[model samples]
Target: MKEKIIEALKRIEQEFEVKICFAVEAGSRAWGTSSPDSDYDVRFIYVHKTDWYLSIDQKRDVIELPINNQLDLNGWDLRKALQLFKKSNPSLMEWLHSSIVYFQAFSLDGKMRELEDQIFQPRASLFHYLNMAKGNYRNCLQTAAINSKRYLNVIRPILACMWIERHNRFPPNEVQPLIEALIMEGEVKRELLTLIERKVTRDDHGFEVDFPIIHDFIEKEIRHLEEYANSLRGPSRDFTATLNELFRQVLEEVWSQS
Candidate 1:
């Protein structure tokens, strides 16, 4: 599967005339709770040749392939990625920290890691996760019988919010670390671990009749995180110049060798 993903990325580079600087697994696979039937969610950041960026026209900054049952491949242009990095986009941050890496070249990963502390906006990240939790809960978990995957969708974001609130940093992309750190040894932890075990071992489309303990946890955390996220302040530092310089360096590094 890794080899297949790498080949797909190589084909993307050839087809689009771009250099893939970094790529990683995302979604349930990266979060460590994928069911056996989960599809590959491959995300990457790429840069086109120097001349590609010299134009004034606003070209498309994203590349999305047709999704199949087995693979969902997509990527962001480097400029688009850096712009999101400046704004402390949670999705980009997660990509940088994802546990599964298919490819990484040049110094894009290292450079971004260096700027993570300066660029991280706790308020933005919190709200992003908070909203994810709220939306998933409202949309999927309203009834007594709930989709297990939907329950996880809500729980993971809620856990992320807890991590950010307690540590005041971007949470890890995986779910176990969040569970280990945020949840104590109790019924809640036991129930969550059981759900995750079932999710990974079996098909997640099946509905579980009841998870009152988990539901209660989710509701309380959503309310508490909403208040906490609202009370937090935004990032004070501006990283535009730094990110721009890094972007130039990457262009030089990638194209100079090309």
Candidate 2:
């Protein structure tokens, strides 16, 4: 499977004529709670030769391959990545911190990791997580019997909100650390652990009896995080210069050297 993923990425490079700077697992596999049949969500950041960006015409800044049952692969151009980084897009940040790395060119991934503190906006990230939790809850968990996988979708973001509130920074991408830090003791913890176990081991295709304690916790936390995030001052820093510098550096480092 790993070899197949690499072959696909190589094919993407050939087909698109861009250099892939970094790639990682983005979804349940990266979060450490994937079912046996979970698809590999491969996300990457890539760069073209300097000429690709020097044009007056705007090229598509994203590359998406057709999804297969096992591999869902896509990537953003370096310019698009920097734009999202400036906005502190939670998905981009999570990709930077993802545990599964399929490929990295030069120090692209390392450089991105180093800039996380300078570029991350806690308020924006909080709102992002809150929105995800709120949307997933509304869409999937409104009934007495809920899709079991939906519980994880709600719990993770709620925990991420708690992490940001407590630490005042971007939360870690993986769920276990957040669980360890926030849900150490109580029946809620036990239920979460059990759910995680089942979700990882079994096919996450069926609805299950909803757990009230988890649902109540999610509801209360969402309300609390809404109030807390609203009170946070907006991010004010202008990271355009920083991002531009990094972008130029990567282009020189990857393209010039090649």
What's the CA error at residue 66 for candidate 1, in Å? 0.9
List model 2 lDDT by residue over 1-258, tens digit each. Answer: 888988999999888988998899999998888888899999999999899898999789999988886899989999999899999899998899888999877887898789888777889999999999999988765665555577889889999999989987788787877888898567778777777877887744564434688778889899999999999987788989988999999999988767
User: Clashes in model 1: which pairs?
Assistant: none
Q: Per-prediction TM-score, please?
A: 0.95, 0.94
lDDT per model vs. reference:
0.87, 0.86
- Candidate RMSDs in Å, in order, are 1.7, 1.8
- In model 2, the runs with Cα more than 4 Å from the true position are 143-145, 203-210
Q: Positional deviation of 80 in candidate 1, in angstroms?
A: 0.5
Instruction: Report how far residue 153 has shifted in candidate 2, in Å.
Output: 0.9
lDDT of 1 by residue, 90-140 (tens): 999999989899888999989899888878899998888899888998877
